[model samples]
Target chain A: AVAMPAIAQSMPEVKWRMTSSFPKSLDTIFGAAEVFAKAVSEATDGKFQIQVFAAGELVPGLQALDAVQNGTVEMCHSASYYYVGKDPTYALGTAVPFGLNARMINAWFYHGGGLEVLNEFYKKSGIYMLPGGNTGTQMGGWFRKEIKTVDDIKGLKMRIAGIAGQVLAKLGAVPQQIAGGDIYPALEKGTIDAAEWVGPYDDEKLGFQKVARYYYYPGFWEGCAALNFFFNDAKWNELPPIYRSVLTSAAARANVDMQASYDAKNPGAVKRLVASGAQLRPFPQEVMEACYKAANEIYEEISATNADFKKIYDHMRAFRNDEYLWFQVAEYTYDNFMIRARARG
Target chain B: AVAMPAIAQSMPEVKWRMTSSFPKSLDTIFGAAEVFAKAVSEATDGKFQIQVFAAGELVPGLQALDAVQNGTVEMCHSASYYYVGKDPTYALGTAVPFGLNARMINAWFYHGGGLEVLNEFYKKSGIYMLPGGNTGTQMGGWFRKEIKTVDDIKGLKMRIAGIAGQVLAKLGAVPQQIAGGDIYPALEKGTIDAAEWVGPYDDEKLGFQKVARYYYYPGFWEGCAALNFFFNDAKWNELPPIYRSVLTSAAARANVDMQASYDAKNPGAVKRLVASGAQLRPFPQEVMEACYKAANEIYEEISATNADFKKIYDHMRAFRNDEYLWFQVAEYTYDNFMIRARARG
Candidate 1:
């Protein structure tokens, strides 16, 4: 039988309010939500229009989870770890210290049964989550002084977050949680000695290089931070199947897009930072070793206390072990050789 | 103004035939096309149903492109590199020796102007292309004997593809382009000494480890192989805006899904292969160095002769260089340290 031709059909104009944890100025982070909304609107032929609000416009940044759960808004775009105060399992939805990297997370979420576990965890909260955005791997942080040993972190006042901050506290450093906007002034005024944002693209925008000279490598705390799109369960179930597929597809695209934006933009930003006299340095092995040890202790402590944390953490750890072995053989070997070879030329 | 509610509306029923280059037995590769079709159908509320035909069911696998271009079918899912015989530029649409990895390709395609260049390249053929799927990094190949030095490659009859085969030939090996199904028999009978398909998931299905004990890793030629969804230009232009958006979103999801499937499945497959007495190994540095040199020379020769190849090659190389540098700092540093630390524990 011949197929019928597609004809113009007026779609129902559904508008949604989406609260983002980020202010609009950080385009790559906040811009992902806008990209997703645009794609959804265009895909549904204006049937689905989501109005995005910067952090404080609808509710406080960290309170987006509350907004989503209470049905204050139909949806929200925020880092899942921001709601770890409610349940530590929420941190796994985003990232945790020494957890999966971007590729591994993608594998776990889409293929290795991560999304199922996470959605199950979210069932108690009356929300459904989708992978929204990723910032590949973040920089360790911007530091005013080089961190050489475990002792160097002692008594150090730094702006960090979540489990990483807790691990840092174990190392005798003072972990202060500060707002994004406030981090720079604190660093500049010596109220804080170090701070980490995302990577070069977003970091350069925050002008972290202006106050910090020693730029550290690899944010082990957040290997790859994922942002999630939270939908009210009732609102989500009420949507037509087509809209649901579009939501998954659009968010998937946004996830790749945000990280790509960071990857493409960061090179130029890093070069500029270096030209402006910022010194790039790998965190000393001693510091990394110390952090790793502290991170394990914190994980053990949390697992011993929190059933939810233990359940998800155990699954994540197992998957990570397999992922690393495979990657070490296929990915790392290729990348290490290629990078060095490319450098030699 | 408050938004109107979505009501069930009668929709257009469009059916198209999609030819895939891969056989259905290799589910991850061929399964991607089915996945895309299913997503498209469900997203359009059963209005858009695509009938997927495996390789040789309708037309030959490699000729899927011709079927799409000639309008014998409205769409076809195949790797663009399969058309390297038509134009070497086609390799850029898929992969090249040491080209962009899965994440880098996603970054380049979605964010770094790869899709623009590729689609512009495809315009001459009256087809539009979308990123369909990827096989993360591939295993180098399976060999009957261990290859420890550059000289070990000489006089070896191996099945490889694209520029990689050409590079292998330069190293004094006879590069045979054997079909996937024929590789096992050829290897079993010793007509071919070695072959490379994809990674462990697909490789296990092909049962290569039974004949070839040494399974080498990090396929240099295809660091990541991408598959594309080709649409007849006229047919693509005929798609409604919403349908077009759905197509983009669906394809993007498929891209992420395929790689994730490979990453998630390969580890277990590799473990099984090892248990079955297959030895896992990396290609030696001497051999890698030789292949890199030969690959560069071939690229130079191609650029000197083919303008299209040169144009995309130059653009891709520039983008790849920047991508590697950024990835080196953020991605590599993080993964390397984590893998080592995780291993120690």
Candidate 2:
């Protein structure tokens, strides 16, 4: 049963701290961490609070996973996908090419049992998990020039996240991992020909369109990139059950807020990007098809080698299949009808 | 800005009869309608889907307030507060007197809210509002509770909801209110003790919970009660939108299944209630003394004017003030430190 104590009032207080891998200026991402921490504090009657710190304050921006992994902090709000350098499997936590969308990922985590399976994997990293946010179906990246074919990907240097970088590498692209704050300078001087951040909201905020005119769609690598709160396993275990529930519930709230933030803010940001000479384009069918094929092959390899990864992947795929079947019949039919009507209107 | 389409996964053509006062359960409330409807349909996807009936299905349950208002069909899941007739305002929602329990209401709404509220209000009338679910904090039923030495009155009937009936009567109390299924019986029932329903959750639900519960608190009226969605609100407004966001969000998922319906299945449902039962008890000697005095003078003047009760009440006090202020600080401190620690352990 869910409990909310009111009027008879008085809630317990909690003080906790968290380190985030993004700057405060990135509202959706960093804002999500802040909101989660604040909600936990308030909801628990301030009995549980998580003080959040921006990247570089607690540790180097890119090393957030390590900080939490080693218990350098009580908790760290960071993207697990960033640590593919340590293990390829880490990328699955954030986003991957041809992966699920934001809503789909949430469904998978909460109801589809992804949380249970993923938590099993997170145990190895010595942290417990809660979804902090999601960058709903990100944009491909800001590119200096258009690519009409798979060959165009060769010799291009791009800053991207996770195994999608590995896929790019396989396609003969050089993948660079850079913290968000530093992406622009590198892109400006041709240090990198392309960089994939999140969607229009964050991309516009980072001034990415100003540097790269050709903006691509379907960030294949991050169909729905999700961020997470990595609680030091020991600290998580020590928390009273209520606090833990608060933490989890708070994460769910942040997850919803992050998606809404992007959805709400992106419509305008996208317009601004287009007005500012950013050429928004869908990846050519050939490119998308090739990438999908490559993704499948890569997935097969990972499944064979990693037992845990295989387990989660199999379960996720099965649920997705069922969901797709239902969605195709209902959501698709309704969406199609509405879109057509909307267009006519 | 959050929008969910009205139609969900299509149903296998079937028939169902759902009774609710709400126009198809509007999100939080409608979620329940959808859950029940969908579950039944899904469980027997091809065969049945209990057709939903909104307020006034047989007769405006609020007016027809059910004890099986109009000899309605099968089920009704709503808050107890809507019907304050057989008793009074306190009987309408759940309980008054510092009441609002997630699980207890789940029990009451499903068991008590439905059984007691419907039975108390409609036993002679023969209509019912099953306990499908509850909206957590119903405004103190617009009250008429009064006090002078906390002993000035002993048999004043009221339109009330839930167990608060027992509590209020304990403090010089008769409580009553009609069921949404058989509300007219109650408004017409001189047998009323007092009535108290929901606030906004109240307004949208039994309409009467809003219309009547208002007629007291801080003393004997509902301090906090869950508003319910009694059916027979005219077979529930056709049910398409109700099935999607409105009813699904309300009934099945209102505030995360509330503390009702599912509470019994919960493992430790009763422990916290018992430990906290003491807290649930009436205002202490000093507190009741001051409040009782204030309530009387306020009630007399409000009745005397027959003018704006809200306006007069507004001048008397803030919606949530001094007592609440203390809660944010010290009360929260004690709760977080000792109370919470003990509750969980």
The whole-model lDDT of each prediction reads: 0.88, 0.54
In terms of lDDT, which candidate is strongest? 1
Residues B165-271, candidate 2, lDDT per residue (tens digit)? 54555566665645544543454453453444333332333444322333222223333345454554334434433133223222323323332222211112112
- Once model 1 is optimally superposed onto the true structure by TM-score, how far is the C-alpha of residue A208 displaced, in angstroms? 1.4
What would the per-residue lDDT of candidate 1 be over residues B1-345, giving only the tens digit for each residue?
A: 733323223234678999998899989988888878888887776778899999999999999999999999999999999998998889999999989888888888888888998899999999999999899888898999999999999999999877788999999999999999899999999999999998888889888989998999889888889999999999989877777888888888788888888888988988898999889899999899999999889999999999888988989889888888888987899999988987897
- Distance from true position, residue B278, model 1, in Å? 1.4
Model 2, A1-345: lDDT tens digits are 734423111223446668888887787799988877766654433445678989888797678878877777788888878776776666667766666555456657754577788888889878788777776666788999999999999999999756787788878899997878789999999999999887777788888888899988767676577899888898888866545645665665566556545554565577687888888776776676667667778889999998877887777666544444323321222222223322343
Best model number under DockQ: 1
